[model samples]
Target: MENKKANKLIDKILENLDKTGINTETLIDDIKELRTYALEEQIPLVVKVLRYTYEHIEENNSFLIPTLDDEPLDEEGDVIEEEADSPVESLKYLLSLIKNLKNKVNISDLKEYRDLLKAY
Candidate 1:
């Protein structure tokens, strides 16, 4: 029951968006179902999405920056590559995304990811 409700709610949220116009009406019913389930279940649906968003953000932010190369660029013009994503900066970006979503997620929610980034 909870799964069905959650699925419906998530569907509704997706459907109501302009990007989801194709299945708009279908999602509407699911969204209503999800809302009822959320109210009865006392589950924070946004929290789950927030967690996923944060993880995805962290992955996207982890990239190679071509600055720490041991040798200068050759005739090909390829620079040295070094890992990017400074921990503090990454955390800031994650916080910004969460802020942009108008959702409140505490730093502790991403503590493990932050710690891993810090190690980098």
Candidate 2:
């Protein structure tokens, strides 16, 4: 049952893309704003956001998700922060990520802030 619905949704999305001249990059950038905002009890808000952004995405046309990877880990569970491009911006990105993931798990390297410092 779900597969049928999933296929329909996928087909509809593909149909819309074909009808509209939207490409992969357009979809990516359009949906990027939704990368932030932790999932909470606000199910309706989430749905509304997805709908609003996806429907009116082109007008917004900016803001990437600040998603980051966990810092490398050693056998001893130590974090190995790596230097990312544009240290200051990277640091800010990590800081925001840390704020979100702090309660969930121990992100020791703070998304590689220390590694970025060493490179600086």
Candidate 3:
């Protein structure tokens, strides 16, 4: 079943998160597979996040990790440049977002958006 397949993929992803070094290519492939499930399930938020994350990683070769502060100063008082997240950190962050997605998105709102798109 699709649910079983999705669960297997999620388990794989979670396992990878615990490893010392993550294989990004495999992770990306897993994400793509999961995105298909999201599309079939009509979970717009998951679909969008997965698509955007995939495109971003593919196009930029890096994940967009936001900095905690707009301008961070060291003890010397000079502004510190923000550092990019490692692939593993990026994966973890993505997983967290996906896990909390239900709380953040309303299914009714997504349905309304879909309806609006159909009207156009």
Best by lDDT: 3
**Candidate 3 colliding pairs:** none
Tell how far residue 10 is off in model 3, in angstroms: 2.3
Give the better candidate number (1 or 3) by lDDT.
Answer: 3
TM-scores for candidates 1 onward, in order: 0.25, 0.28, 0.57
**78-106 per-residue lDDT for model 3 (tens digits):** 99877765666655645544543455343
Better of 1 and 3 by TM-score: 3
The best candidate in terms of TM-score? 3
Q: Write the per-residue lDDT of candidate 1 for residues 1-120, one digit (tens) a residue.
A: 235546544544443433533242443344344445545655454344334433443455422111121355767898865556453344334333322222334334344344443444
Residue 22 error for model 2, in Å? 7.5
Any idea how many clashes model 2 has? 1
* Model 1 pairs whose backbones collide: none
RMSD of 2: 11.8
In candidate 2, stretches whose alpha carbon ends up further than 4 angstroms from where it belongs are 1-3, 6-46, 52-63, 68-72, 81-120
* Per-residue lDDT of candidate 2, residues 37-95 (tens digit): 22332333333434443444344342222224657898999998666544224323433
